[model samples]
Target: MLKELDLARREAEVSSLAQAEQDELAELREWLAAPEGAKDEHRRIAGLRAEVKEWQETYKKEKASWMRAICELTKQRDLQVSRADLFAKQLGQWRDIFQETDLTNLEQEWDPESSFYANEDAERRECQP
Candidate 1:
């Protein structure tokens, strides 16, 4: 009887140890199936990277369009400045010519009753038809 009792006790201890090991294995498997923190952080990082790439592409396209518009406006402004400079030069030439002329002594140069106007009037009336 004593020997039988000792064997039964030993068997029970072994069974308990086996149960503990099985529990630990099941816990480890559950932990592996659902991790603590790293996977979620990795997903978030990947999403952020995609968003950044999209923003960079948008910025590049907008920057290129703005640069093209600036170039076109700059060309138009340069053309306008050149035309204004040409007009200024012509006005200066006309001013110089008019400044050198004597307008106060105009009656001594020509007369209204001269044959020049009489002949010019006659030719103008004839050409009107």
Candidate 2:
């Protein structure tokens, strides 16, 4: 009879433990359903998404503006290079004229009886220092 009483007591103790475990599990589920950390994490993710969208917009505008500036600069550079090429061609022409023409022959040909000055030369002489 004592053994039977012990067995009954053991069963009752196990049943109480099982009930306590079930109550603890139910409380844990309730806590998880409305967790403060989960809510905060969701808000943080939303804020980050908004920030990323703003960054993308800003980046697009900046990229477009930068590309326009680069195009303008490239055009200017091309114009400058063309001007330099034109100047170089003019300088080559002048150098060829100087190399081919003899200053001594010009002086010999400039006698008052044999040669005459053009109207432009007269005007140039008038302006000379």
Model 2: number of clashes? 0
Residue-wise C-alpha lDDT for candidate 2, range 1-129, written one tens digit per residue: 547856986797689669868865775566568579776665575578569768966986797688679879999999999999999999999999999987977776676644456666777889999
Q: Which candidate is the best by lDDT?
A: 1
For candidate 1, write residues 28-128 as lDDT tens digits.
Answer: 56556766685566557557856976896698679768867987999999999999999999999999999999898787777765768888998899999
lDDT of 2 at 55: 100
RMSD (Cα, Å) of candidate 2?
26.7
TM-score between model 1 and native: 0.52
Worst 10 residues of 2 by lDDT: 111-120
For candidate 1, the C-alpha RMSD (Å) to the true structure equals 28.7
Locate the minimum summed-lDDT window of 10 residues in model 1: 27-36
